[model samples]
Target: MRRREGGARTGRGVGVLRVVVVGLMVTLVGRLWFLQVVSGDRYVRAAAGVSVRTVALAPLRGQILDAAGRPLVANRTVPVVSVDGVALAHQADGGRAVLGRLAAALRQPYGRLAGKIRMCGPGVARPCWPGSPYEPIPVADAVPVQVALQITERQADFPGVTTELRPIRVYPYGRAAGHTLGYLQAGVGRDGLEAVYDRDLAGRPGRRVVAVDNAGNVTRVVGQDPATAGNSLVTSLDARIQVIAERALATALARTGGTSGAAVVLESATGRVAALAGYPGYDPSVWTGGVTAGQYAGLQLLSRAVQGQWAPGSTWKVASVAAAANAGYRLDARYGCPSGYTVGDRLFRNFGSADLGTMTMRGALVKSCDTVFYRIADELWRRGSDVPRRTATGFGFGARTGIDLPGEAVGAVPAASARPGDAANFAIGQGGVLVTPLQLARAYAALANGGTLYAPRVGERVVRPDGTTVRSIVPPVTGRLPASAATLAFIRGALSDVPRSGTASAAFKGFPFGRIAVAGKTGTAESAGHRDTSWFASFAPDPAYTVVVVLSEGGRGAQGAAPAARQIWEGIDGLRETR
Candidate 1:
């Protein structure tokens, strides 16, 4: 009986054990099923996140070429040394030994190199890295081939250090047209053509899918999309002409003791800028790797060609001449060449207060007789004629030239409610009248091209890397001047005599007028507290090109600016030796 009772208790214990084991097995199987079917993709993605990384591949920037296909701003490949921040941080001594080794190989100070690798943040000064801490930091640019080879050859000593061939901007002309060509700061456009055409110049960036281990070491390149280089920019700037203009401007600035100046050469027919030069220039190469704020502020970064606004002076007389003709003043009519003209209790004196005998309207222009223009302006104001303002606007003043470059200044013009004195000043390009060198150039270009005013363009076309044309850039004709063919021809004939027997005659005393007939005007404007602003606006009468020069604090148009214009014309006509 006892044995039977013991056997029954053992059977019950075994049965209860079996039931508990079976329930445990069922829970384990259900959990495994849920994990495999419901959450499998989530875990897989998490796994991928740990091992895969995507890196951006920067595309090569395009080249800037001249009209003759010569490189103005170009690129060259150089070895750049870089250090991976994450890998360096994982070092036993926190990258000190590795950086020291790298510094020795690079012949750079260890402290300077370390400062460059440090991620920029609060309390950190620059030369500090401004990019992501996970990526490699470029510590050295344009490193020597030998130094780059040494570091790469000994990877164990310089862990995480790498040498890569990267393209950097090289100015073949060296500061020639620096302001117009613009520059790149840390691979981003800052001004001029670089900023305006940044999108087209900067092609699409590619991607690289890389695999890394737990220690963030790149194991393999999973996939890559090759970067597409930017399209090349073809500009209308003639390098030879640009050099000539620049040299001529420098000579003028030095000879006249002027502080600043600008010169523009434009193709009258197409309105293409051949040469645009500004004095007190700087080297664009200073912005290769990067530029400091202090360094940038100290540099003469302003492009006086498009950004400078000055009194048009007597160069404004041509527009006035057109206005007078439109107001029923006959071109052949005689106007007095008095010493001064009185208006509203104030006497507007001619330049040097000279009194000459009466002459025809054409002869007054030839002598640049200020009293004559002042009288005409007063008469127009008395009649309440809008011809002055209309002619000024039609000639492309008081508005931007719509150039492709950035930071263009829209000059000022007198309002409709101007007084007699104001009208006189406007006629002489003073008081409230202002015009940019570019605006004045465009105005003269319109006069040269027979009434068609263009918006002017520097870039001629965009081309692909394979030399295929992308698109031609043709600037539209903004408006038409109100001057008729007969009026234009008459004015042209008067201007033709300016360099030969007028105010600019002395400057062109020995110039070859027969070879290159230059039609122009000379102006010496008064400044309240500064020396007179000198101006000379001229164009070849055959209507091929127009050249304009202006000098601040320069004594007179004939003495300061006209000589430079002569030099440029000589160079343009390939008669530099003759002059």
Candidate 2:
């Protein structure tokens, strides 16, 4: 009986064990079905998240070339050191140890390197990496080959460090056309043509969908879109002429003890600027890494010939002469050439207060008689006529010349309610009548081009990477001068006499007038508590180029600005001979 009872208990225990084992198998099958049918896609995406990365490929920036196709602004490739922010973040101590090791290898300050890699917050100093945390941030540019090799060879020391070749903007000419060509900051245009045509110059950036492994290494490129290089800008600037203008302006500034100076050379017929140069220019390469406070402060002294405004001084007499002619004041009419003209309590005088007794209107202009213009301004003011204002505005004064540059100053003109004193001042290009070197050049160009006022153009054409012409810039005529042919001719002939026997005669005494009929005017504007501003505006008929030079705090037009203009004209003549 005991044996039979034991056998029954054993059978029961076996049956319970079988039931438990079967239930466990059923549960496993249900979980497998749910995972395979309902959650498979989610798991697959999660797996891909660990291996896929998006890489941005920067496109090559187009070359900024001169009229002769010489590069003023360009690009070059150099090895750069980058850090993977995401991978670095995941490292111990937020990748500080690795960055510290990298700092030693790169010979860079660890604090600065760490600051650049770290995400910036409020109050963080600049030079901070501005890219996304997931993307690789370039820490060192133009890294030495040996340093890059050292970092690459010791990957264990820098888990997230990478060395690769990248394109960087270069200014081969250094400070030659720095203002006009503009400078780049972190692959962005800041000013000049670069800022004005940024969209066209900065081409589309390409992207690549890459597959990276758990070790943060690229396994394969799943998809790629090639970057398109920016279109090349063909400027109207003549590199040779630019050098000549800058040199002349610098020499004149030093000789005259002037603080600053600006010079502009334009194609008289088309109003296309050949060269725009200013003193105290800055090097564009200083912006490669980014400009510092000191560097930027130093650049504040830079002046743009097309943008900055100053009292045009006697160079303004061209407009005054045209205005008088338009108002039926005979060009040949004789007036008393006095040493000084009194208006209200102020006494305005010509250079040296030398009285030439009596002289015609043409003679008055040749000698830059301030009293003659003062009398003309008095008559116009008495008549309550806008002829003077109209004439000045007609010459594109007190307004933007529509130049192909940014931040151009639209100079101020006397208001309608201007008094006789203001009129007198305006007549001589004073009393809030300001003009840019480019504007003065444009006005002189209009006189040279038979009364057509052209909107100044700098871009000659746009071309593709293969040298195919994308589009050519057509010179646009802004307006026509109101002066008659006789008046224009009279003004032209009088201006021609200027370099012969007028204010600029001394400067152009030995110039070859037979080969080239050069016409010009000289101006000196008084500045209270400072040296007078000197000006010289001239044009050569042979090559049809208008050159305007202005020296701030320079003594006299003939002594300071005229000599500089002479140098430029001679340089232009020499250039023609060589070519």
Which runs of model 2 end up more than 4 angstroms from their true locations? 1-42, 47-53, 104-107, 120-125, 186-189, 211-221
The per-residue C-alpha lDDT of model 1 at residue 129 equals: 75
Worst 10 residues of 2 by lDDT: 292-301
Write model 2 residue lDDT over 471-535, tens digit each, in one string. 99877898887788788888888889998999889888999987778898998988878999999
Q: Rate the local accuracy (lDDT) of all candidates.
A: 0.87, 0.84
Model 1 scores worst on lDDT over the 10 consecutive residues at 183-192
lDDT string, candidate 1, 198-284, tens digits = 887888888888777667777688899989999889999989889999999999989999989999999988889999999889988
Stretches off by above 4 angstroms in model 1 are 1-49, 96-134, 153-157, 186-189, 213-216, 417-420, 541-543, 575-579
Candidate 1 Cα lDDT to native: 0.87
Question: What are the models' TM-scores?
Answer: 0.88, 0.89
